[model samples]
Target: TPTAVASTIKAKNYIKTITYDNSQEDFVEKWLDQVFSEALQIRSDNKFTDEVPQRYEVPIIGFDCLKSATTLIFMNLKSNKYEIIDRPGPRSCPIHIIVKSTENSIHLKFIDAKNYVSADMELDDFLRDIGKVEPCESLIKESWLLLSAIDNRIKDYTDYHIDLLQNASLAKLSCLKKYAYCYKNFNISSCYNPEDKANPFDLSMRYWKSKVNSYNEQDKRKKRRIDHNITYDDYQHFHDVFLTQRCHMCQARFTYNNKPTLDRIVNEKSHTKINVLPCCPYCNNLPMTISNQEVYDSLRNDMRNIKISDCAIRKPYLRIASQLNQKRRDVNAQHHYKWLTLQQIIQNMDYIHVTDDDTDSLCLAIAH
Candidate 1:
């Protein structure tokens, strides 16, 4: 270890860097080869370099090492551990972090062997300049999910270690739960880290997101399919029919993003003036075969009874709901038969016989 530390000085490293997270391993894995390429003779090696750059001629101050390197990595690195050499600090620091404190002075210690290399400062000048680091756990979780889904370990400090260092408080490494995840791998006795476990949250937020996305897509598609007679002004007029956007069938007040939608009084009919109501998506989604008048009558009666029922709102509300349920079924039966009649007329439109006068009137209307 001492010889390794001494070798860095022999290597003629120029600028040094100190980091607070696990970036050393990444630097060595990614950047080391590009710095010291082939044909460059290392100082420790006994063999002669074949293609030496023709700039310098000496062995220790030779063109071989000179061409290859101006800096070196002073890192003591191994599996899950990295330490900076000759730096005065605790070994446990992955990325060095020190919170600001009240006491005026700091014990300035940089080099262990040299006494004159360090000096104390009254202010934490470096921290004073660098502002607060932004924590982005959601972005981290997104990436982690992808890696976990593939059952892959994070390849570098940039992949996971930086996030861990930043979000030190909410570190839920190797999450066992579906809602949360984390990266910590050791001493995980009971909890399974969701970050480490890929398929735990169904391995597919995208699928569910797409499913939810279709709702909005369907609404847009519905608007496009509106009758040619129903212009933008007609839509504005329909919206003005309601004092507030409320569900016609269930009478649920439209709130949040539940969204106000248009419902046909009868599914067989188009969005004519008498055939549509402004309602909640919940009511529109329910394929009720009852007329809007029946729905309104049932809901209104239920509301009146609910308000004046002498009992507290909570206890007998279900009774009013129950009474309306029977009335709805009766109304639904009547509307269903009427809807079938309309369907038959629609189906027989091409086959139905017409008088010469009727045909002439239809042709003239089409021609005009």
Candidate 2:
């Protein structure tokens, strides 16, 4: 089905010219020239000069009458055509102008003039335009709910720093599992089992210390128990070991297929700190967090089951009087059914298996 088209109207004839009184004439001119220059520069770069003519003019006025005329010009042009010239106007004597494109030129005018007439008309037009736009009810509702949940989580973490730490650890573990594919060629068992270790890159101790200190300060403010020992280096170590080890979520020692996999948390000190959960290429182009793993797993399992069922029934079959059925027909039917059942059983078994490795394996891998 086609999606609903958004409501839109070209504000081509709403605002034309803006005139500033003598008091604001200088500032208005400066603002007008700057905005016009910027627009022209952008247009020139994009080769939009033909669509938007190059003959732009900045008109300056000193008297009230010129200001009134500028106001009138602004009132006639479209809202979209009129580029906001200056900062938002002040109450007593505001300073700001807007540019309105004209037939072969552009007109500059003040934002406020004698009558509240221009402002009110523009506002009315804006409101009417807004009414024309299509509303995505479902998207809006979903976004609001998601935002509310995030806000609540943030507040909870703020009140309890330990809550953030707990969430971070879980998130880091999930991240490691996602990128386990990268260790297919390597001895994953060694990586998963910290005792059977290999030397990997060192964790960023400085980065981890900063994160721990930040958390500590927050904990003090909240009067909560602080775990200052936990550092970014520790998280990095955990991530490095996970990737070096061939530790699938299932704890199976299968070789990886050389696909590009990302560690969940990127421990860059400049942009991010401690552990940053990376995105999953398979899941809606979104980064997978620890909290979202359960939801993702459930959905993935359901989809897999549905696909398996669909595949098994790809061909239509009818039960016949079996006592004298052809030997070939009986064998073929039995073979097909058995194969399907076996596939389903394997899938179910795979889904139930989970590795019991601790975070220490990941930490040790990176430490090496």
Candidate 3:
């Protein structure tokens, strides 16, 4: 709001400080430090003048100025606290005197909803030029989409400007949303066209994408190291065992209790067919943080009694209850004839397909 001080012709002794709120673009604070302080001194030494009524109510002036991003509403520190000054609109000026004090050598800075941009305004001229750089609507929209993709900001594409107005995540995507909303609402035909090589937002988007790509590659490498030997068939076979009965590790009944997963018998060993077993995710994870001296089986079994745990099985987890509807839901035959238990195994034995080589290994597991 210190925008007023920039246009001041003479020096002043009464106005102490000015502040800026950047509703349109961010460059005012820097402009104020490098340019506005001297302007205030000049304007104040000569005389103070306002294009509009100087005696307008502070609240009304503040509200109008914010919408147009024209005037600065500041306090007169030298005067009573109740007296708020609404300065002349920012026509070509960047800083306006929002507040004044008896102690002189005026200073102005920008403050936004988040934080200050800089401590001192050494680069004020460079900063002020930012306000003059008018970016095109199409460029803004294009950059907005690019940034959105990087941030993974999922929202309704159809009528998103209206539909996603209430999204809390929009706050993080403010800059992109600002351009998008502006393009949807305003006529951008007169806005200054950006040069092919000097688009700042485009540069920012490229930097963001680079970081995202680097992170993705690192994550892929880590995943590759973790499951290099675990094949698709191994996973399907593990699920087959888990769906049929309790976890082979701790004998925990599987009613979505930590939902089953495959884990290595020895963390140091590769995920060979013999090394992996169907265990609850919670039991499997114990080996990662348990005592380093403990064997995998000892560590896994130590915390296996914990029945309540969570698992994020991204893949489809199909349940195997043998013959799901072959027989009626006969409560009377629950013991031996008609249930999702072992008796259904008899009816669905053909689906089991126990190979001769695996017969001994599956005997105790199937009985459980």
TM-score, structure 2 vs. true: 0.16
Against the true structure, whose lDDT is highest? 2
How much is the lDDT of residue 298 in candidate 3?
31
User: Quick one: ranking by lDDT, best first?
Assistant: 2, 3, 1
Q: Please give each candidate's TM-score.
A: 0.19, 0.16, 0.19
Candidate 2 — which residues are off by over 4 angstroms?
A: 1-200, 203-205, 214-225, 228-368
Overall lDDT per candidate, in order of appearance? 0.28, 0.32, 0.31
Consecutive 10-residue window with the lowest summed lDDT within model 3: 55-64
lDDT of 1 by residue, 250-315 (tens): 444443433455666655545555666766543344334334555333323322101222122111
Q: Over the stretch 104-162, how does candidate 3's per-residue lDDT look in tens digits?
A: 43333221211112323222221233222223334333233322332222333224332
lDDT of 1 at 145: 31
* Candidate closer to the true structure by lDDT (higher is better), 1 or 3: 3
